[model samples]
Target chain A: MISKVGRHSIRLVSELGELAGFSGKASVALPGQRHIMEKLTRSIFEIGVRCVPITLIVGLFTGLVLGLQLYYVLTKFSSESLLGQAVALSIILEIGPVFTAIMIVGQAGSALSAEIGIQRNAEQIDALHTMQINPIGFLVSPRLWAAIIAFPILTTFFDLIGIYGGYLTGVELLGVDPGAYWNRIYEAVSVQNIVNGLLKALVFGIVTTMICAFQGYYTHLKSDIPGARGVSQTTTRAVVYSSIAILMFDYLITSFQMAS
Target chain B: MSEATTLKLRGLKKAFGEQVVLGGIDMDIPLGSHTTVIGKSGTGKSVLLKCISGLMAPDAGSIAAGDEKGAPPCSYMFQQNALFDSMTVEENVALPLREKGKAKATEIKKRVSDLLEQLDLTAARKKYPAEISGGMKKRVALARALITNPEIILFDEPTTGLDPQRKYSVFDMIRSYRKRFGFTVIMVSHDVPEVFEISDKIAWLDAGEIKYWGTPDDLLANPPEDLKPFLNPQLSPA
Candidate 1:
């Protein structure tokens, strides 16, 4: 049992190291990549524009639920006017970035992983190498750049829509003073809070995108299975691992911010 | 290595774990000649081709280009015709040039158009790989491989899942293109007498070694003892 535990620990560390190296190489290759703006635009369309509807739907519902629950809780303490502060802080600082990332993972990250996995299985990657092309530069660097540009933008959208959902529930439906709610939100949210939230989104974007791409790129070598089954397995792992990384990094970033 | 030689392999060795693939392969491929390496299913013909193409590094050996230059540029046509499904046929054919970024957009377009016209792929230029037939995919792959005007081209089982007629057509296309382009061809194939038709030299790989290397007629006139069983399965000691 001890030996087995030790073996798994070592494997985990080794995989983490490999993931870091993969991300580093992809990042380094970014400057020299050809037709990068075109590729980056396509990636942004896939990862950002296509994900808007789902992100908005999830964001609105989360705000509505928070508004409904927090109104009653504030009423218990005769603090109903604090609803805006609560909603804005929750959406901007935590829910917005986290949910946006998870939704993108379900849609764009999974697709990226599967596409790359299929390419690997079909020997298209090897074909590129034989053609004297850098596979990572051609295949991955644009996606990374797209994620960096898209994540913060999506998170901002989620936050604005979520705050509106809260306003509808807190001021229009419930009976809190609109001026008080808006004023509380204005006074409560500082530049630092918004900056911290966007920073989290940026970090989550880089980490999750790298994890998904890494998993798919090395699917053939990593999976015990082969062919379509192997592609499926690695793609599933990509989604799961990316989602987990988002949450884990959220905690680490949150804790670090709080400490400092 | 003679100036006539385009590629030379000396003591090329590769093994996966304990299973030895290519034990010690030594061979020279002449410039502008078609050489096919034929062997049984598990005898590592693909492995040897990959090693030569720099797709897979050998465990212990040196692969040399005969030119004074360090290593000649090579293009590989994979067994499955690994064309990018997401890219249209024209885009697929032009990808290597586009990635290399050495040519302008107009030049790339002209070169791709010419190659596609030559390969009878102009009609399918806008279609994706999934939309095209297998033979057309092979031609597109060939166009991509030939676009850079590589000094050497490595083909890995270029006709694995094709009918005999299509297979023969692919071989004819390869032979005709080789003559036109003057590029040396190193192919791994299993089409037996069919493959011998286009090959200038045939290297028989078995037991992790090159057991026979000669012209097709030479191999047929005096087949080695071990190769005879493979050449004519009825001669096997069943």
Candidate 2:
């Protein structure tokens, strides 16, 4: 049992090291990549524009549910006026970044992983290498850059839509004063809070995109199976690992922010 | 290496864990010649080609260009064609030049246009790989391979899944292109007698080594004893 654990630990470390190196190489290649703006624009269209509807929908529903739940709880303590403050903080500090990331992972990240995994299986990556082209630059760098630029913007959209949904539930449905809801939210959510939330979005974006790209890029080497099955395995792992990384980083960043 | 040689492989070796692939391969490929390496499945023919193409590093020995400027410019045509499924034929064909970023847009456009027309792929230039027929895909792959005008081209099972007619057509395409471009060709193929038609020389790889290296006629007339069963399965004793 100990040996098995040790083996797994070593494998995890090795994979992490490889992931770090892959991320560094892709980041370094971005500035020098040919036709950078064109690739970056395409990637933004894929990861940002295509993902807008889902983000708005999920954000709206999350706010409604939070407002409904927190309304009843606050009424028990005669603190129903705090509904806006509660909803705003929860959406900004946690739900906005996390759920937006999860939604993007489901919609865009999976497709990216699968596309790259299939490319690896087809020897397209090897063909690039033979042509004296760096596959990481051609494939991953633009997506990374897109994630960095898009995630914060998407999270901002989510937070706004979610706050409005909370107003719809807290004031329109629950018969709370609309002025109180707006006033509490206005006073409670500081610039630092928004900055902190955007920071989380940026981190989540980089981590998730890197994980997804790494899994697909090394699908052949990392997977025990071969061909289509191998691509499928790595893509599944990409989503699962990215989700876990999001939560883990959420905790670490939250803790660090609180400490600071 | 003589001036006539394009590639010189001396004691090339590779292994995956305990299974040795190319134990120690030695061969000299003549300039502007088509040399096909034939072997049974899992015999490291592709591995040797990968090593020579620098896709995979050899565990031992040296693969040297005939001229002493180090490795020659080379392109690979994978068995699956390896065309970027997302990119149209024109984009796929022009990718290498675009990535290299040396040529201006006009030069790249002119080269891609000329090659696509030469390969009869002009009509399919805007089509994705999935939109084209197998023969057309092969032609597109060849166009992409030749777009760079490299001194050497490596083909790994260039006709693996094709019907007999398509296989022959692919061989003819390779032969005609090799003649037109004057590039050295190193192909790994399983198609036996069909491959012989386009090959200037045949190298039979077995058990991680080249067992026979000679002209097609020599291989047919006096194939090595172990290679006979592979070359002519019907003639071998049941």
Candidate 3:
């Protein structure tokens, strides 16, 4: 029994190694110029175009809430007017990256995982390999490139809408001075803060999409199992892992920024 | 029975955590040949195909193509059409070519049209896989496989779950296309006699080993009761 268990351990490691090698081969096998165009268009449709209205709606509400909440709390300190800086800092640094990524994990990441997983289960990836078409180039690279390009842009959009919402609350609703609000926000927020937030979003996008894709792609490793249980497990694990990873990464990045 | 293409698999082995799927498989899938592998369910017929296609690499053994690269890209027709539910029949057929950029949009559309016409699925081209019938879905998969003008096509239980009419029709389609294209057709199926009709050689796999490998007539006359079950499996779906 002991020997049998030992043998199994060795076998699992070897399979994992092979999978890694295959993944590496796939990553290097890039699509042609035209295929890249199609992938880019698809990414725009999936990540940017489809995500815009949702991001705007969500971002705006979050900003408005942040402003209202901050105004109520800072009123005790005779600083209700500081609502502008509070909302801006929160949206620009924390809420924008985290909330946007989680939202995308639901929207884009889930879609990506489901699509790639179904393909893997259906043997389409195998078909690609047999055809000498690199599945990585055909599947993974487009997604990697898309997340790298789209997430930062999406995060920026989220931040903008959120700030606008907070601005609306502070100026139109709360009767805080507009000039004072912008001045406070501009004074507290710097280019480095913006860069840090955008960078976090970019990294989160890649990590979230990749984990989901990998989970989906390797799902059929447990072949012969009936039902969508495997798919369910993969999707759940993807979200959980991605969220934890994003948080861990967020702290590290913030620390780096603070130190430097 | 032998053909130009040579796919050599030596010391081919694969295993799950505690289960050994393909113990040690040595096979040659030649070009211009119709080889059908019959085995019990869960006996790794599909796994063997996956290994050969490089979808699931075996723990041991090496699969190498003796033919030239881009010698008609080998297309795999999965047991279940494996159609992208999202894409139209035309898009599904165009998938590989679209990825490879082997043809312009006009040419792709043209080729897709021709395939649809040939398979009598022209009217269904705009429909998604879910919207189409199971038989139609299988045909769409076949169309997709043919779209690449493959060097060889590996089919996993090509007619496993179809109705009688669709099953025989699928058989006819598989045979006629192989003749027309002169491409190697390697199929892993349990449809015993139907496979025999199309197969130039038969390899009966049992428990991760090739128990029997010969021509249909050779096996029929000197019948093994072991292979008899596969000789006439219920064509109806389970």
Candidate 4:
């Protein structure tokens, strides 16, 4: 039993090593950067344009709930004016990056994983190899780079919509003073705070896409069986792993923000 | 045909964990000749082709080409007709040339157009792989495989799932290209009679070794007792 466990552990470690190597190669630019423009455009549309409505809704609801909940709590202490600072801080420092990434993990990351897994099952990746093209460079890098470019911008969009959502709930619905809400939000949220959130979004984007792409690229290496079922399982695992990475990295980035 | 470029494989062995797939296979593939590798499913005909093409390394063996310092010049048309779904048929065929980056854009486009025209795939040039028929995809794969003009081309079950008409067309295409380009041909196929008709020699692989290697006529005349069953399955069953 111990030997069985040991063998499995060794296999896992080796697979992780392979994934790291694959991602390292993908991070390097390929020879034909101009050629990847098509891929980049497709990925940006998938990760950014298609995801906007969902991010907007999630961000708005999150801010509304935070505003409504914080209003009641702060009112108990008669410091209800702190609602704007709380809402702005929460949206800029935590909710914006984390929520945007989770939405993308559900939307774009799963699609990327499924697309690549299908490609692997269909032997398209092997065809790339036979043609002497680096599959990582041609297939994986553009998506990774596009996600890195899209996530921070998406998070910023999320923050703006969320702060407005907070305003709609705090001043109009809950009867908090509009001047206090706007003034506190403006004074409390700095460029550094927004930058920190964007940084977190950028990191989350890279890590999530990398993990998902790694899983898709190595679907065959992960499973013994060959078919749609194996590819589906790998895609499912990619989404789960990518979501976990985003959350874990969010905590790490938050720690850095606190320190800085 | 160009002077046959000989590819020699010595003691080619491959294994997956405990299962030994190819146990020390030794064979010579004469350049400019079409050779079909026949074996039962999972008998490693495809694996041998992959090893020959450098897609997969053998566990213990050497695939010696004329090149001393570089990899053997070879291209493979995979069994599945692994065409990129995102790209049009013309793009798929032009991929190898594009990846090599040796030819200019106009040169690559002209070569791709010429190959497509020869394969009768000019109409399907703008269509994606999914939009075309299976036979067309196979031809596109063949075009891609031959575009590199390598010393040898490896085909893995080129007509495995096609209808009879498509299968014969693939065989005919292989025959014509072998004559036109003079490049060596190594194919793995389950379709015996059609493959044998075009093959200069047929290699029978069983139990991870080349059990028989000779002309189809010789193989039929005094067939090895072991390969007799594969050579004439209907008669053996009767």
Candidate 5:
């Protein structure tokens, strides 16, 4: 009999192999431009359009809190003029991408998992296979590409709103000179910083959606769970795993940038 | 003997770990004929169909189709109907055509509408799978399977969970369509008498093998010892 650690190691290796294979296959299973357009539009509506109001609200509140907190911290060092710089840096470098990713994983990723899981249970995936349709290309790749397109757009919206929220708190509420605030923010944030945040969002979106879709695809293959119970558990696990993957990859990418 | 052997299974074997499902199965499904496979639960009835349909590979043995050069398109109507809940009835029927890209959108729409009408599912064409009844779902699945104009159609207990009337209606629909399409039909079923009515041949699987293969009359007139109890339960000292 294999030891407990050995069994777990085998399972982990198997999962990693499956992830690699699925990513490779999905990359090549390109749908036609017309098919892509149809899928992407529906996906953007579900994943991006629906999350706008909540993301906007969250961005504004997070920026307001960050600005108020930073003012007091900087005031002690006679550097309250740096309030905009701090808030802008945090939003662009970390908060915008990370928050948007978490939101997408919660909203879109969970639903994707549940939808695919139900399809699997209902034998719809097998039906597609029998019809000679590539189930991954039809069901999965569209969502992955859609998330890639949607994530950067959502992040841009989040950053702009967050910056405005910071401006409100710093210039209008805290009596920081509006000119100083605007000047510091403009000096602190560059095109590279905006591009970096967008890159993070893109990676996070791809990794999170891939994980969710993979989990959904393999839900029936999991022996320990079956039927509706498997569907529910897999949905929850998809959300949790995608969230953790986003944070972990975020740190890893940031570390790589820092080291380079 | 009149119909050619469209599908031939020889020494087909499959197992899950130590538990062997199909130890070795050999059978021939003739072209343009309806064949019913009857077996107790867990006897690998569906497994055999899966292997024949190329959905699952046999651990050992060969399944040779009539065409040695190319595989004729085949469709399987799953026991659960397997209709996409998100799609309307007509969309579900049109899926195979769209997937194959053999026809334009207008052509696909026309074919789907005609199929819906023929299947008496025109009223449900705009309704999603969830909005339809089990009988309607079965007919929808049949329309989807027939849309591709496949040479072989595998039915996995298509009428398993329906009332007696619904079951008979489904059988009637299959009979009428088979007369028109003349596709080879291989079905796994638990409904003995009803399925026998539509089947030209019957194969009874027991203990991981085809214990009997012949016409329904032959099976009733000369059943093997192992199958006697199953064929006539009243005679046994129960």
Candidate 6:
């Protein structure tokens, strides 16, 4: 099963590289990317802006759980103060970005894939080609840049809400002083840590969008063609491929950091 | 309609791997003429159309327009109406304007609105492709073709899967549109009689060669005994 999953991951990346290869060359300006800005703005409104309330709720509950759980474990060492650092590190470095990426993939990524795949299968892509418009520009670039911009914003929200939840659990539930807890959190969570987490969030964004778009556009037997089942399959493949990719990349980056 | 003046094909050949689709085709379409090329199911008719539209390039031979070297930018209509589902009917219709030259939004809208109304699709101007019928989709395809006001427009099997009356209506639309715009129409069709009705000339393409190229009148008068079986049903090859 592990080997098969690895192969699938490689297969997906290979497909994406091949499909977007043409665009990479046809593209004159990486900075001149047109649709990406619009995509980022729209995604910020939809995924980041609209998702704020839910993200806060989820973040708060997650922080509370971490604090409560760590309280028991750290009690053995009489290290209750570690609660702040623990919660901060977990939320900032790991949970926040991963959780949010998974969420967006479920919400927007798969839907985008299905829609584009169906358009491709339906011959709308071919129609665009006939007219000499790049399908990647017309479709893929916006979604990619949007995710890159939007994920980091959402991850920041996740981290903040989670820290607040940690505060609630550390002060209200535990006998820790509220003043002490806030002080520890502020002192323990440095700028470098926050930046690291944001960097991860940005990478996660690119991965989620690229894998979804690539899977959607290339999973089909051919391009510029449309069918209902073909689109469904495309959506399914996109979600699966992206989820696996996120996990694999997480492992590689984390391991690289550890080794370094 | 084979005119000697515009859109000439000389020894056009296309191949996929070793499988040659169009071995060699030589023909001339007159200015503002409708010539329907008829053939059996897989006799490279669509490939020939694709070559003319620049959708597919020929391996050898030249496709020229207006007694010149390069083809004047032409429009192609697919067998499937390749409309952008994300865009509305009017937006889809006005797409060619973006390609030819940038036009003011107001001007593009006006041109799109006129085409939509003419096709009797003004009611569904805001509707998506999924909201419309196949016939309407075909008509939208027609609208998109006419949008660019291309010098040459090629339709790939224009009336495939329509009801008989709708097929006739599409055929009639093809005829009237050709008359109105005065652009050359090179269409691929199975409806031989219908093609004969609108086509100024007909090319009987069989087994990768043109058996005959002449006016429709000449075709009826000198119908090949061998092709009669393929042209009409309930007939056997001689």
Candidate 2 per-residue C-alpha lDDT over B51-110 given as tens digits, one digit per residue, 9 for 90 to 100: 988899999988777546334778899999999998999999999999885899999999
Per-residue lDDT over A1-260 for candidate 3, one digit per residue giving the tens place of the 0 to 100 score: 99999999998688557655655554555444346787777876787678878888999999988888888898889987777788888998989998888888888887777677778777677666765667777777777777778888888989999998988887899898998788889899999889989989988877787777777777786334533777777777767867887898889988987899
Off by over 4 Å in 2: B1-4, B67-70, B234-238
What does the lDDT read for residue A173 in candidate 6?
Answer: 83
Inter-residue clash pairs, candidate 4: B4-B31, B5-B31
The i-RMS of candidate 1 is: 0.6
Question: Where does model 3 exceed 4 Å of error?
Answer: A1-34, A222-226, B1-20, B23-30, B56-73, B225-238
Model 3 Cα shift for residue A248 (angstroms): 1.6
Question: Of the candidates shown, which would achieve the greatest DockQ relative to the real structure?
Answer: 2
> TM-scores for all candidates?
0.97, 0.97, 0.85, 0.94, 0.95, 0.86
For the second chain, the TM-scores of the candidates in order are: 0.94, 0.95, 0.88, 0.92, 0.93, 0.91
- Stretches off by above 4 angstroms in model 6 are A1-61, A174-176, A222-226, A255-260, B1-4, B66-70, B98-100, B207-211, B234-238
Clashing pairs in 6: A120-A225, A121-A225, A121-A226, A122-A225, A122-A226, B1-B34, B1-B35, B3-B29, B3-B30
* DockQ of candidate 2 against the true complex: 0.88
Q: Give the TM-score of candidate 3.
A: 0.85
* DockQ for every prediction shown: 0.88, 0.88, 0.48, 0.59, 0.62, 0.41
Report the C-alpha lDDT of model 1 over B1-238, residue by residue, as the tens digit.
2364567788899999999999998988777789999999999999998888888989998877664533477889999988998899999999999988679999999999998998889999999999988888999999999899888889999999999799999999899999888888999998887888899999999989999999998988899888887898633433
> Cα RMSD (Å) per model?
2.0, 1.9, 4.6, 2.3, 2.4, 4.2
Model 5 lDDT tens row, A168-243: 8888999999889889989989898888899999999889888888888878985258998998888898898888
lDDT of 4: 0.85
Compute the lDDT for candidate 6: 0.77
Model 5 stretches with alpha carbons more than 4 Å out: A32-34, B1-4, B67-71, B234-238
lDDT of 4 by residue, A65-152 (tens): 9899999999999988989999999999999999999999899988888888888988888888777788888878888889989999
Q: Which residue window of length 10 is worst by lDDT in model 5 chain A?
A: A26-35
Better of 1 and 4 by lDDT: 1
